[model samples]
Target chain A: MRGMPVFALGCALALLLAVSAFSDEPARAAGFAWETDYAVALQRAKDEGKPIFLEFR
Target chain B: MRITDLTVVDIGLFDFDADVTLYCFVLNADEQVYLRYGGRDDTSPDAYLNEKSLHAALEKGLDLHGKWKAGELKLPARPAAKKPADYPSVKSEVIDRKQCVHCHHTGSGKTKLAASKGTLDKLKDLWVYPDAANLGLELDADTGITVAKVKGVAKEAGFKAKDEIVKVTGNAVYTWGDLQQRLHEVPHDATSLKFTVRRKGAETELEVTLPEWWRATRIERRSFVHAAEPFPEFWGRELTEDERRKYGVKPGEFGAEVTKFWVKTNAQSAGVQVGDIIYEVDGTRSAPYTGHPALWVRLNRKTGDTIKVKVLRGDKNLEFSFKLRAKAW
Candidate 1:
């Protein structure tokens, strides 16, 4: 039972490191707060009563 | 903000000018487009787009949104939705697992399809993108959203410089994007255009007559022309009489001075250099008064046609043969 808590701690640390690696990438720094999924963005726009700024390139 | 490279079938609703490579749309969730942001004449992405213009378009879109919410502005009815896969080029590309058909290619693809259906017309300007300059309204170079000058028809119709165009053809317009949308909806044969402008805290209505060739687009910039006609991959301007004289060409003869060549195009591949004067195309002495050489090719030649061009490079006259290729974008 004591080893179980230690395993959980190890798993949490691994997850944290994995997330840190991802967060440090250049894409995260330079990327705008743009949603890539159109359906989700459209729903959010409707819910928030906002217009969609759609960039198609 | 929605950034996407995914092929959305609903692009038909926008009725884009086909050659648009980068396009930004400000619209409601219901697909009522408030305006658009990007347009290009040259192949370069930054040709008519800049950070300041995009920012101004966004600000104006938000302002228009406010009016829309307050019921003060009415937007046009949304078009029936059609999937992009329904487009022939897109469908073929998707089935072949090739790269998605670009937005600009849609116009030429449609033109080719029309040609296959025996309905090709040289005079028709397929996918005409509207420029406010047609109405004599010059937009600010930096912002591209504000009115910098109103001359000719717009000025004669009581429009003044600095008057922000608030509505066009009964639809609210906040930026050039919105203005373009409204203008696109205008019938090619429409005799007049109605617009409302905000000037000095008041909105005024004005109407202007449409020019005869108002529906005609700049052929050099149109991808549809490149797709369907035997066109050079370089851009050139019609030579003035003085330029013709300097080039040793007879007066009233047509010649186009090559100014720039798009990178990686057939012109560059064929060793067609800048500063070369195109004096003849396919044995025809290109008449200067007829129109631009590129436009002349678009009007006369069909796709797959081979064109023999004579260029005066310095004092030497050189000849080159170029084949028209289908739209590759």
Candidate 2:
């Protein structure tokens, strides 16, 4: 029964990694944690009263 | 690295020039662009961009944002916008899949639509990427606000060093991004611009007339059909006189020496290699209306048109015949 619980945890970990690997978001740069969603970034900019540094590469 | 902890977004519906490989825009929440931070030439990215320059652009963006918040500056309205899904190539995705299209493919899709309309010439200088240097106004790369020097149109208008441009074409320009936006709205046939400058705390206005061919753009910085093969998948410069003589070509002959070739294209499939000299296509000696021979092919040929090409590879005179196709992105 304990082994079953550990196996479930392993499956969950693998699923999480698989989902992350398939994410469309690019790898984060060294200093900035770039927001992949444009709407979210725009809203955040408005809330923080900040300008957005948008990059297209 | 200096842009750390700032709000950075990786995607948007913004329509950029086709040739822009990478670009940065600093803008407020209301979508008022402050300035642009990227430009490149045929040879290298170093011509218009570097780490120091980008840092300068970031700082300028922040300064402008602060000024805008403090009511010291007012930004102009953005130009007419277009959605990526409106493009024919990606319409299906926008309608059926209901997903945001990839930013990189936007240019390609737009080009495809132009090709379909047989109006590829419209693609020439399409969405000309503007820079302050085009007007002879060199901004400080670190601050991106103060005009370090002026030349060309800016100089002819009596602009002096350290003169801060407060407005361009009647639009408030707090940073290079704002200036670029105003310039982008300039019609291709526009022959003049008006500027408001703040010099020594005194405001003055000046008008500068642009020379004809101001719309002429650098071919390398444009996005158009490039992979229409038997056109080589490469970029080259006009062959030198000595190079023509060494290849046994007569004087006044037209040819270009290959400098770079793209991988996995028909050029590679047909065994075209770098350093090959392309002299003729379809028995035409050389009609290089465009500086680059490949662009000439693109403007003249259509998809599936089989063309005969003559390439001088080292000491061997080689020939290639291939059909043109749409670029594979």
Candidate 3:
């Protein structure tokens, strides 16, 4: 019974990490997590110091 | 790892032919463009599109980005920022209509605006994003930069099949799109281009001779920019092999039978009637082997220019003089 709270906290951390990993990107079954919004993607790119793979189709 | 599909936004400062159905740009947060990764020939919308090539481009883009972040690369100043709404044509055709500004609107808008201002040069302006085939180099459909065939000017330049193209005019190119953009920038009158290729294991430099009108390409069949060109005011079909034999049309010369007058065009004013076989325009007889002779006229002539058109009506050869005019887009 004493480990119950610690177990719940660990699950919460994992869930948090999962959410954050896909926070800016919409989840997809396969392929890339393509951000549909350019402004938001641009901001995220600036924050992450990463290059953007932008497609105009 | 960040991917963005620019469907829900305006492409301000992004310079590309929106007429292409698919296009990609790799850039850093500062909007420093590292490389481009999409292009097409007149044949197909995804002619040069390859998964492996795109992956290669993305990897190179990241490398360029890293070098840039580490101050190991120097990029040119970004081009002046411009938007679709900046052009009046987009306002009426897209923005004012409450339509999502399509990717192509940006290019059509700019060309239409230039047309309205009497600055659009049809001969030069209509040809956008010429293919690498113009250089007589056929790149591998899967790898993008590997030379699959070399003929014409490329063969003469000493380019060989299996040579991996590394750079164009000294600019490193990772994908077909990168090479195309660089080729499009070559001056219309340029006599030669410098190519760096990986032949076997050694990097070799070759000088590629530029054919006249190397920048000219077929107008995209789906683009509205064709509306800005001078209307031939006539429709025609290419002579078939039998018809060519009958008409004495040489294998490489242009020949077409005027099926109908599309509208009251200047050709009609000059007495060009249905059933007239058009064979030459303004003293030029050779064409790119496209069956339609009118294409040559549209590509070579400009609004307000007067030229002589030759045709054969029945057994008598005839000629007509007419002034080319622009159509209301």
DockQ scores for all the models shown? 0.25, 0.19, 0.22
TM-score of 2: 0.63
TM-scores of chain A across candidates: 0.43, 0.46, 0.44
Q: Candidate 2 lDDT, tens digit per residue, A3-57?
A: 1111111221211111111012324212224465667766877877778777655
Q: What are the runs in model 1 whose C-alpha is more than 4 Å off?
A: A1-31, B41-48, B66-73, B142-145, B215-217, B230-254, B257-276, B280-291, B302-329
lDDT of 3 by residue, B1-329 (tens): 32223223445556666677667788777777888877778877767665456556766776888799899998878776666678888878777777777776666777788888989776666776777787789889777889999898899999999999888888887788888888877776678999999988999999988877676565635355455667665677778889989999888788889997656777888899999999988888886524466777666677788889889999999999988777622
Which structure is stronger by lDDT: 1 or 2?
A: 1
Task: Give one digit per residue, the lDDT tens place, for model 2 in B84-186.
Answer: 6656665664434655455445665666676677665644444355666767878765445578988887788898999888878887665454565567678
Q: At residue B291, what lDDT does model 1 achieve?
A: 40
Top candidate by DockQ = 1
Q: What is the CAPRI rating of model 3's predicted complex? A: incorrect
Model 1: CAPRI class: acceptable
For model 3, the superposed segments whose C-alpha errors exceed 4 Å read A1-33, B1-12, B220-225, B236-248, B257-277, B281-284, B287-291, B299-325
Error (Å) of candidate 1 at residue B73 is 4.6
Computed on alpha carbons, the lDDT of every model, listed in order, comes to: 0.65, 0.59, 0.71
What clash count goes with each model?
A: 6, 5, 0
lDDT of 2: 0.59
Clashing pairs in 2: B34-B177, B34-B178, B35-B176, B35-B177, B56-B142
Best by TM-score: 3
Q: TM-scores, in order shown?
A: 0.72, 0.63, 0.76
- Total backbone collisions, model 3: 0
